[model samples]
Target chain A: MDQHPTIDTRQTLETPEGTDLSLYPAGFWIRSLAYTLDWLLRIAVVVVAGIVLGASGMGQGLTLVIYFLMEWFYPVIFEVWRGGQTIGKKSLHIKVINDDGTPVTFAGSLIRNLLRVVDFLPGFYVTGIIASLCNRHFKRLGDLAAGTVVVYANSVAASPVLESVGSRPVPDGFNTDEQRFLLAFAQRSSTMSPARQAELAQVLAPAVAPGDPVLAIKQMANHIVGDRTQSAKGHLL
Target chain B: MNLEQLRIAIRPRRDWEAVDLGLRMAQQWWWPMLRVWLIITSPWLVAACVMPPEHQWLVSLCLWWCKPLFERPLLMILSQGVFGVELTTREVLRATPRLFLNQVFLSLTWRRFSFTRSMDLPVIQLEGLHGAERRDRLNVLHRIDSGPASWLTIIGVHVESFLMLACVALLGILIPEEVGAELWTWGFWGESRTGGALLILFAYIAMAVVGPLFVACGFSLYLNRRVKLEGWDIEIAFKRMAQKRGLPTVAILAIAALLQLTPPMLPSAQAQSEREAVKEEILAIKKGPDFHRMETQRVIKSTEKKEEEIDFDKGFWRALIEFLTGAGSLAAAVAGIAELLLWALVLLGIVLLILKYGSWLERFPQLLPHRRRREYRPQTLFGMEVTKESLPDDVSSAALALWQKGEQRPALALLYRASLTSLLTVGVALREGSTELECLRLAERLQQELGIPQTSIRYFSDLTRAWRRLAYGHQAPSDAEGTALCRDWAQYWPEVTRG
Candidate 1:
């Protein structure tokens, strides 16, 4: 069996920085839409309850009691069980993570929703609204208390494609061993800046071609690596 | 393996894979929206269906009157009862006028009120009435509309209007249907048909129309008295003018308590009722030409409108002496003044308590402290400046400091800036202008060039993760675990740079 390289350079090259955590700062309109939708759902729930309970004082009181329980407990239960979302939030393709990029805990979820009173401040959450507007992260008082961030749940690709090196003719200077080394180097350097790659290519060029330099080096690499297959094809060259 | 070798062997993968933590709590607005809709529509629907056809208009009007106060519960009840669904009282309570008032008050107090530049109050005022007369009416209306007095005045007005409407309805119902029809033809809807009902109906109508107006006028007089006693009118007038000029909502609300005394300061009904009968008699006779003619003739024939018959000197002098002898009046005035002072003291105390203590109570600790020193000193290895000793022992405070520092330059960059720039010089490393994402991507490339394992690259991933957490999370990295994680990553920087 062929031995795995001591250092898997290909694997290292393909790795990215951070965990590809793709979060966009949700804009005001999108947030507003979410708020609107949430309100609509709440209203629908209340309306349904009222109809079932009827208009008597006792019925109304019971309905109110039901509403209170749902409002306070629904989110708390969902967030704890499903990692921070009710049905509406899940549907919107968003999730709440703690500031440390972990799932929200029960106490955290409870406190955040409970502190909704403070966020409400003086009236229709004017304080909370202003705080949210001022904050760069789109957090309101509840989020602040909860230590959570709402992020879009979308994934991003991790690697860039490289050029194929199969078409160009081989030159006369370099041997097969040197050409293989250069191709491996070029593949690893796929994500590097063009200027950096060119600078590196300049240093290695003379070793392969001596007098003709760049042209001889390119031809030598082509012949040893079999017609510049991967590099020339622009597949991670 | 050496520590550096181990680091390389164990680095974590850093690809653009998203971790969807799920939707946030505040982002859910469905409850409030649903509550408001149910409030506005349920009562309207119920009132429509339950009331008799003829009474529908009256019921609808009453519902409209109660709409601001009753909408939420009505809707909640309707929705919940019919559909077996429920919502929070907080959601329903959010739609009331009181809630709106509280919000307006807070906003005004916070200095956030701003009226549109194009809003022209005078232009709106002019769309209806005469110049000098309209100006006087508008001034009185503005006075009644602008402050604490305005709310009291509004309540009084609504009460008076309701009473008058009830009386009219009663009288209308009492009149013979045939006579009502006859009077309808003669344009006597305002008088004959309704007026020729029982004398008691007429008397009740007279009392309803005249009594509240007299009381309102008396209250206006008392408003002036209290204004003089407490200097409230000037304060309110200043605030009103400022609000009209587009002062913030907060500032407007801040002036509400200061500009008006609570209901306890107003005149009692007994004191004001002494003058009530005279006002009622005048109003009743003024209702129709027949009554007015008869009353005027009787007054003219009996008193003869004498101009010079009475001697003012004797009457005026006698009244002055009696006023001085009236110790009861002095005591009454003093008692009223004392009561006003007491209320003023109470209100001032409340305001002071709110200002002084409310903020203090808001900062109580969030969670129990974890017994881990490493967690507390996460950034120690980076040699970054963090004044942890000076910070409050609260989690939020520590988190805030760490977050603020990390925001300026992340730990990975700090490591590069300090010692690792040389190692990165030869590979596809991050430059000064590269973004966090770009740096991570470049680090991945460097890992490849150096033959570093995917696990070893996790230092970079962790650094970026901490940086983002500090930057975006509402709470700073407060927990011991979070802080320790930051510190550990800071210490792990040398391994990240090692080829």
Candidate 2:
């Protein structure tokens, strides 16, 4: 009943300029970390600005303006100008892009950051956290309004695969995963206790063979490898 | 194809790989992951700080109970990230109000107490399945725990406890010696509820750091399972490969057509009987009361399911109304009543006919065409020609000739591939994409089982080493070394056909 079932998370988008770009969104914590980093940096900058503009009424007014500009417009200015990254976003290797994986436009940047107030409700960005958590793209209210997504700056490493020796046909009713499990079970069971082996083999017993499942699995393992070596056998090479 | 050129691979991964991928996922998404962890647990953090040590755990217990509240949002965040989608904070929060009822129901289960709950979170919060369908989906998803998710969750909880204790003890150091002594003592926690608050606060911090990882691991395992079950990875891999090759339509199109031309693995009679037997078994199960109940529940919310049952009070009135309205009208207008009744009966008969033959009727068009197997067949493997007849009859001598001619690598590959073929015939279930080490290990284990001579094992081991060296290290074997392997090949596969 999911209005949108997982339909696969690999998103493909045609950029405004008409090239296809694919991206994986950054997770909540990674983006939060970047945001936290940015927050700290901004706080430090504000503190320095406060000290520099020390107690005079004129200076106090100037500091307020500086703080307002920095607080409200920091992310917007940097995101639009610095290739969709603020200082924090850049450090964490995440960037803001349109929903279609295109570079963020100035308008997209402005709207998303502007909606930050709503996302920050009930304090500590809780509303925003909730929004990002429940959202498909981890977008806060701002990003949703602007139709932008935040994606990992770099590509994910390809899944590591066991080295391919060659194409070998698996037996009937068994898939590649079963083949992997069978092989792993067989290899690991060599050093396992008999009781443990029996316990584990019991689960696989019905599917593999009738009796002495462990032995059958082992025999199959031996058979699959075509091991001709015996404790005592002389064969022509 | 070489590793670099292979655009993408879609397949079920080993357990370690799955977990490693979880860690990889965490690294990819550390920020919002960390922030949300802190944000959700912040209340518990406050409770621990303000309340005494004794009362602090109550707060934790509460947090633990309401874990699903915290879990759903986090899962959405991670799942979206997995798919390369991003949402801002409020956007994530925006859906929470709407899903409040679902969260309450999903979070109520005892399953939440264990780490295994992490695996189930996505189904509960995301899939939008209810009642029986959710149960069935759970059955399919949780068939295997993959071991790590549950074990890690327990370990994380235990570690959090210890870390909490350590923080409490550290707090003890800041107090006066007498108070400090009291603080560190076992009864000190029991003496005051407020005393433990500090301890709980620190524990909350530790939990934030550690909790998501276990949850992420569970989530990762869940993701991996779905990937395997649904072939998501394969679909993505194929898409990537097609894109990289810039032959999106042609290559896959050709292969898809090729698949259509292949044959089914089983004979028609045997396959048909097997299919029928399976169908019968399914029918028998489906006919049972349990199956009917689950089926009904699949599409309905658990809450509304009971409403569908007959209401005894209303049932009588409805029956009375039906009986009273029909007969009196019939008496006044017999002809009209008879004509209406006849039409109703005809429509009922037509409805019954369609229901009875619905499945076959839907399938009628598909049955007209001659069918073929649609399994994907590998064309080239191990950068070598692969065919039903590619394996040599005499592996050793063939390799020996190649070695003499200074083509040592292909010679070794020939011997290795031959050994693999021999292994497959004997029932070693190696796949095409397995690495050399995996092959070596499998062969080593099976070599002992087959009881090949001790000298042959040693020699086979040496040849394996040589291949591993040449393939990965790019170091060629010396003349003497090459001749020695040439000597050993005949020993492992004694029945090698003479070239």
Candidate 3:
């Protein structure tokens, strides 16, 4: 087998390879709250209905019917109409996402909610609790069945700023195109290593420096990129 | 459009100094949590004591006629107070009883009023503290900025509270009929009514208690959800928040509501007597004097006095026994004993055979002329003379060659054939219908005809065993063992081949 230097590059890409999917345990309190809220609503509906209609067999039957309806439609109607949330979920600042991290579809929502019975397990969510404890994503039976993920609604970090060419002075020897190239380099400086930055700067030095090479290179980078003072502070070229 | 410009543009324009000043002011009022709770609860405490009987009735009547208006303020006060107080079991019990009463009243009054119509009113405002700002702060405060009480939560709490309180009242009402009237009178209004009226009243109190308890439960659930999602417990831990805040407020509101509602819910004399009888029966279990009870009391007294002495000697002996006789130690001992016995038996057998056979073997030196008197000069069947220094080449190289080529079956066949051929060449006689065992017997005959040393003949038999294993054993021998066997066989082969 021939040893190839490029093999290291391929290895680099594969070595730290992350699966696009990631699972996070749903916090204990959130699930507990959701469950408590679910029970509370179900019980409230039954009791109030029983009381109002009078605690006869008919009243009990009506309460059960109402409960069944609420159970079936509550999550579906609310999640679809209100950007993926039931009242309990909305309060928790959590939303159900698809396996690929997209908004949950109607079908996905239905599948997850419909599996509530299975998630409920022996009684009071014993199976769901065990599953959540064992799994990384804190997925209950419902989440697993539906291939859904519950995540913080706005947890993604904001992107950083990029420097522009129009804000700085051009180097003495560099032409217009070289100035533009330096700006692009500076814009990506934060992500690049110091060594890489120096290497790229050296590559551009000939075009940039006509006299007093270091000074000329510095001036050209400053001219192309804004915030000359910060550049002078050794953050980047 | 770049990040820096966007950041600058989006940065708040408010004066930091003013905001800081406001925060400083707020910080000054950061009283102890207990103080906050006391302040919130002061009004209810005062109401409970100072409010005249007439005023109490009026408030209860008002609650019945206009439940939402009365419920909201009462709940707000109680919940806020409970949230501030450090929770304790006593507080829970105190709160529970009141909630029980309130739930019953709420249930009874709910029939006369239209709950849906009240629900439609602007119970929750969408602006100010109750609005977007309040929502935002609450999100940050409770860690539930996004999730709010859904209609499901509200409805659920109400129903659950109602049912739970009803169950409790039903339990309370199940006391023997004799004491029922007295208990009802003691807890509420003294008037008696029919059995049906009493049942209705009890149900009413259950409803009252259920409502606030449900609300409290819903709030706790909401808080729990936030904690789960955001690790709100970290904040609670940091802030030294107490669990009492969660449970007590609900209990207080529930209890207060129940108390307010209980005045009208007690049963008539007959029903009261039946309920009293049940209560007596339950209490009787604890009240009776028995040997078990005396023993329990004695144990309790002894424990409380700290008079019992530790039996250290007994414990030490048990520990020592456990250490020596544990499963691991016992297994290790068994294995060590078995290994020692096995080696000793093998050594004994070798010594006994050498002593018993040596003299007899010496007498037949001429019959076995290969054996020397001075030292045992082992020899092979071929004309090649053998000594300890010189060994006959006995193994078939052809068999090894076939094995090296990965033809294990063929190699084994070659070995068997070579052994048979060697035996035949040496004038060994065998029956025509003989099996492999018969071939071994023929090899033994050839060994006797050739006057081969017993050790040399034994080596041949061992080789046969190895070949049989290689050909017919289900699992092949381990690599190291097989390699060692091959090396030993190769060393012995030169001597066997010469023989």
Candidate 4:
């Protein structure tokens, strides 16, 4: 794990398995949108339940029960049983999990949900927004107290498709990070301008001097991703 | 502009991640950003505050309309800050006029509502692009990041309002309830000049907080796009590679040698064979579990769903709806069927429970009342009265007489009943409706629990078989078996004989 200070929102958590999991905490805008969606969904559920149950004549007390359950346990049930996501969180590709990168437990979910009252203090979740802004992990009071965090469920950027160029072995003197950047360069080649691509490849001219640097760099990338057959073709050529 | 001095991680990021990176930037440099924002917007806010209550709205509108001017300075500080340049408050203030000079009129007027204003600001200010160049640059940048940039503005507006309302709500909360009620009576919401000014102040505070974040996030989005489009990370890596090797002259020589020593393309047999072998290995690896995995699972799904897109003409819809709503007969019928099925399932569950565990109740007497304390014996066994008073004083002799008179079946039944009555006395707890087989099972258990004579148990078992044959199958026992049962009964239960 590279621990040098950099401005990014990644929260790296080490699991009991001795592996580090990278979690990206969702920011205020996305969280607010999900929260609004969940609020609307809860209201719609309560209203529909009230109307349906009201017509059945056993409504008042049951409706209060529904209100109470939906208010408290709706989030708890969904977070614990539904893979740590409410419907809103699921739709937004975010989920609640233990701070240690484990699935949230029932107690954790309950404590987090129960403390939503505090997060909503002074109305409009002003306290929560402020606290999240202040914290590195964007945790509100409830998340902090419950030892949970809301994180983007899938934060891995899909590798861009690289055009097939003949493969080659990476030359000496490149460290792992630079080697990874070569792969990134090849992956993002589709997005870069042709002139920009040539410019970037020119910087690696010393390492891949015997061949076309652009072709050589992409070949190394293909080899890095386990496509080794083309290297034979390059060898024959 | 030095890649080494760039504060942010230089990897190409997804658009949302770029927005998040902007948030991190804002968080990192919040104080400087906030200071610059508050300083630039202070004069306008003060001007708004000093206005008459009725003119406050106009003043606030102008203050809001000139937000682009205030944001320009914030962006200037951020752009520098991201490159490890921490501008002092004085530097930011001094640079404010120059920052606002480029396209200020257009930014304040027609381009005010441009959703990607923050993102486009960098192109105009930092890159110094204008006219068609600026438009073309925005077009290229907007292809990937415009959605998030626009959403940043949209969400930024909502956050501003929320924070503003929260400021008012905070004030309301701090005041005691009695004072708060009085505040309403004093026109806190409407006409009070202090209240109106206070509203504008809260709105200013909200804008100040959100503005820096909005600008930073948009700037980050723009930077992230450039990173993708130009491979800044790769460039940084190349710079490091260059510095480590320290071989610019060497690289130029190598390029010259490489151009001169180019080998002509010629396919060799060895290379062809190697390619074939590699292809074979690749295919073999592709066939592994990592590539092709088969899994089986069983899932229960509802099978009764119907397609719901039945097209309805006007008259048909009316008639169908009426029929469906004819006192809700359809709904009632569905509910009725569901209720019946549920009730049937419940009843079946109860019956199955008892049938499966019925013997457990007898084995564990505490499950129900033991019923042994009553000491009340049944007067009948298999519908025959078996009381001592109902039997003859000498059961053996009476059975023997009945057998000699050709009443062999009756004689055997009398013997079986008398043995059952004796077994009850010997502590076999039988029910009133126990069959002959039940009596035999209880007697067998009694033989184990109470050290009853094995001979008597065997005799009872033999008598039960004979009696079941005579009673159920209507098959009479032979004279020898009847006489043998009568003879063995006296030995098994001498107490049953009249004393």
Candidate 5:
């Protein structure tokens, strides 16, 4: 088959402990969002702590410690204890992990969070952004130095129902993924613009049927996404 | 493909690809994106509608600040859309009731003003992980291949502001001069009540459109990052291959996945290489190539003893003696021969001067061909790309050979490079670093200044355009298209000697 090869952009990393970590490093946007969310919480803590600590006689000293802990140990504490979710990170669904896809160890978290100072640079994480942009995994200086990776926390369930109500006889030579792609193309076509539907259809037309295959592909799609109308198997014809 | 068929539904891709995907995905789920925006902004919309005109700026500011709140639902829509599923507005709203506390806790912070908030939405809003797990997951998800999402959010916000200003300005243009005079006054954004209201309205529109797009972009980037991390594309390919061959491919995937986790034996080698990659590829390209020019050939003369002065005197004297055949005529002929010999020596001196300093004398227009002569020995030019390493001989002959072999583009490129190389005489000082556009611009500027003929300039310009169109624009030229251009090659470059 003259296959349109599926290009995998995953960065496969090996661990010191010999675990293969396939990770897609989030870019500036995702990391920045998590940082923003975390920063917001940090500010709230500072405000509350300032009031509470200012009331005490040992105010300034206690405040500095709180600031240091929140700034440095906050991410580390959350990542080590909560399996990588901070209050901010949980909201966004991103997590910290070792470069090899293992749980972020305490040492790894400490190194990464500690190196955040370098990532911070003279001003607004400028060096970090540049570092992230330069690398394929979008690692900031901290992540690079620490050998940590940021990845999307996958959902456990994969049972989301597609449109298919009953079995449709897929062609013999076709694989499960192709069949799934064909079904997806078919299901998506109607909901999509006519031109987009055709475009998607046209791409997979040869896989289903090579010559004047548009109608045949559509029929196959119709077969796969069984009729929704109750009682009768509407694919009678 | 047309706008309707922009791109594929799902795949692991880069930042630009994510941005592009967001825009394209919006085409299919534009309804959901718009609906989510409309629903979230309804309070503001109604407030703006019902509030007094004077107080609208406050409403606008509030709406702008609360964009984070509105973005949550749309983020859901976009996240689902990334997986080829569009979430209904009702479904999104319903799921959010239980997650209200999480959303509120996430929203409250000074970081709301921070630009990086755009990318962070996915971790907090979508994932179920908490504490250390969440942090670890964030570590995996946060290092997005697409730089920082803050750029898009910030740029999106700025673009929205610009769009608002332009729209308000356009609206301001419509009013009659008498009523609109104050509208055109400086600081109208804050000054006049009417202008302020217009600004607010446009700002609202900007928010309505850009807010959804902002979420969509973030969501797409987030999804792409995860897809890349999980090796979804590789898994899909393997799964497909397995189904085709009826082999146990899932186990192979496990092994392949396991291999990646195994620690690299040569970590220092990787680190060393990383330490060495100081200058990025883009910077090197921008620095461009160095220029080198060959010196023109100097005319050399040979002095030999065979150049004895008696040669001309003997022939003339013998001829005079044979033809005239008298004492008085012979004496006259000898005197005439001496005078002729003196004139001949002077003529020889003049010819030697012209031959020895021909390049200097050719500077004068009427004395010789007004040519800019140079040796055809350019080793490299045009970003150091047009090298004659493959063709070691004259350019035209090499080009002809290439053309015969059906190498149309290379042949044209070679011809153009040679012309530019020849133009080095007129101080074209083109360096290896000079880009194609730079070369064309230099050639264009020099055309009139160097007094190159218009038709010849057009030929070079056509060749440049054709070469560029083929190389960069990905368009190939028609066959036998430049036959006339080829025949008039001499006219095109009358200055330089033929290569």
Candidate 6:
């Protein structure tokens, strides 16, 4: 059977430990939002520093040096030691990492930061945006040269809250993933319209016959999740 | 409407992730979407250009205001493209009129300013929803993803403007400096009609680029919201499962279950002895070479936190500056010592260079302040002596006499040795253990290096090949061929026989 391969923009890296790490490379708009936030933060700090240092004429050179360092090494310092995230990237739920899924090193961060000048070429980061758009991993020239990528940091998801339904024995022929899918379907049934919920549940009518398929699937999902308190009652039925 | 035909992976995504997926979709289908967009908007751009100079900005505004109308065809292409349906340009154009008719008034008037316009568009156009139904659909979809959809529009606006300015600035950069100065005197934008038209054109170009991308992202966000609400991925999995295992397979499975209920029997005494025998063999296999083995390694990891280099804390910079200001005289003396040390290091570098390659300077006499002549010759190469004393007084006749005595190999070896002795005497440097070919290449190089005649090098080449064939290939030369080499050897190296 020629199955349609599921297409999505995720970069999967294989570790030496024989495990697969899936990383989602963030695209242009969200990254632009992060850049804008970082830009505002930098400008505010510089302006505030200038105001404070302006009272002392000798502090002018020091202020310029401070601005220069902040402009060049702000991202490098934050990314190398701060778990591959700047203040903006942290807030946006994205961070930089080596293409091999390791933590970004100091040299990797420094090279990528320095080459931001090339990525800024032809004015306004047009080249950077185009390069990122052209590649599968959404990598700019800097990311490509440094063998790094900007991937979304994994956010832990809360366990699904299922409704209270009497537990019943699930039918055979479901693998672990399919069993999880059934649980997810039942858990998210609350958000769906009644018609849509029933329509989806009816697809498995052959497996859950002789009853309301929706209620039957929910009961099986409850049993699969190991809530067996209703087992005695379910047997009496 | 067929979920199976849907191209992208149908799964629940975060609001921003949906927008990112849309960006990827736009990049994937950029050419199809962009071609249709250019075909539709290029006419509007032409109209803007043909407009009078004063009203040019208004025409550009109209083109910008009517972007939703132009973007409908782009969405049509994407909506079909996402379902693995690629529409030709003509197909998109034919559908454009029908698309533009839906909610034309509201889209242009009030909805034009909607920050979530991209996300709202699909409900109106694709679902063909209106009035209260549309509002309710938007309400359901906006529960989570409204923030990112709004942000997308905001960022899209800024990016489009930046791209427009960038295009204009890029043109300004490409223009020759003399022409730019001439245009500068005329106040490029304020006085010239060409400048105004160009700005309007570049603005349209920027919109043409971003509009399709904005629509595609909104459509993807809408699709993602529905996938979450309806469990579309789960439903697809169920449909596939039902298709794979229908009623007949279930009956076959029931029969198999019934057959499994009855167990096969064997005589008890015989079965017990057989089972014990099998168990002993299994135990033996378990203790074999391919079975379990264990090893352990020890490693110590650091528990201390790494110190960060740049501290943004306020007091550090102040203290640094104060220390520098306080130690004025001490800083000056340290700086003076550092300057003297830097000069001494440069002098040390020159002295090291002289010690390393002083003989190389003597090779080029004109480059030196005073010449010191030098000559060098190697006594042995490839475990054979190459001095004049090693060869006979008449080298070709000695080889000819050896050849007459049926010693072909020795005759060629003597001629080859005489050639090497003459070349070394002429200062052609051949390294030790150089194969026959390497020595020939060095002798060829001596043609330019030592002004050796072409005939002598050619004779050396012929002699090296004859020697290599006799030594390595074990193929002796013919009688006439060997004699011709001996005859030419004397003419090429007559001085080789003199002590």
Residue A118 of model 6, lDDT score:
89
Clash-forming residue pairs, model 6: none
| Best candidate according to TM-score | 4
**CA RMSD (A), model 1:** 40.0
Stretches off by above 4 angstroms in model 5 are A1-237, B1-10, B52-54, B96-100, B130-132, B144-146, B173-181, B186-191, B242-499
* DockQ by candidate, in order: 0.01, 0.01, 0.02, 0.31, 0.02, 0.18
- Ranking 2 against 6 by lDDT, winner: 6
User: On a 0 to 100 scale, what is the lDDT of residue B1 in model 6?
Assistant: 36
The weakest ten consecutive residues by lDDT in model 3 chain B span: B4-13
Lowest lDDT 10-mer window, candidate 4 chain B?
Answer: B254-263
- The best candidate in terms of DockQ: 4
Worst 10 residues of 2 chain B by lDDT: B292-301
Note the clash tally of each candidate: 82, 70, 77, 0, 68, 0
Residue B497 of model 6, lDDT score: 68
**Could you give candidate 3's per-residue lDDT for residues B265-301 as a string of tens digits?**
2224445554564355434423422112222111112
Which residues of candidate 3, in runs, are more than 4 Å off?
A1-33, A36-237, B1-65, B72-147, B150-153, B156-195, B207-499
Local distance difference test values of all predictions, in order = 0.41, 0.58, 0.42, 0.76, 0.59, 0.75
DockQ of 5: 0.02
Query: Candidate 5 lDDT, tens digit per residue, A127-225?
Result: 575576455566888888788877766542232333433323557776566666555444434334455344434444445544434444545555655
The residue-by-residue lDDT of candidate 4 on B328-446, one tens digit each, is 76655654554565567779999999999876555433344546423556667678876777778888888999999998878987898788778767667776666678778878876
What is candidate 2's fraction of native contacts? 0.00
Report the error of model 4 at residue B30, Å.
Answer: 1.1
True contacts kept of each: 0.00, 0.00, 0.00, 0.54, 0.01, 0.40
Q: What part of the reference interface contacts, as a 0 to 1 fraction, does candidate 3 reproduce?
A: 0.00
Estimated TM-score for each candidate:
0.23, 0.33, 0.24, 0.69, 0.36, 0.64
Kindly give the stretch of ten consecutive residues in candidate 5 chain B with the minimal lDDT sum.
Answer: B288-297
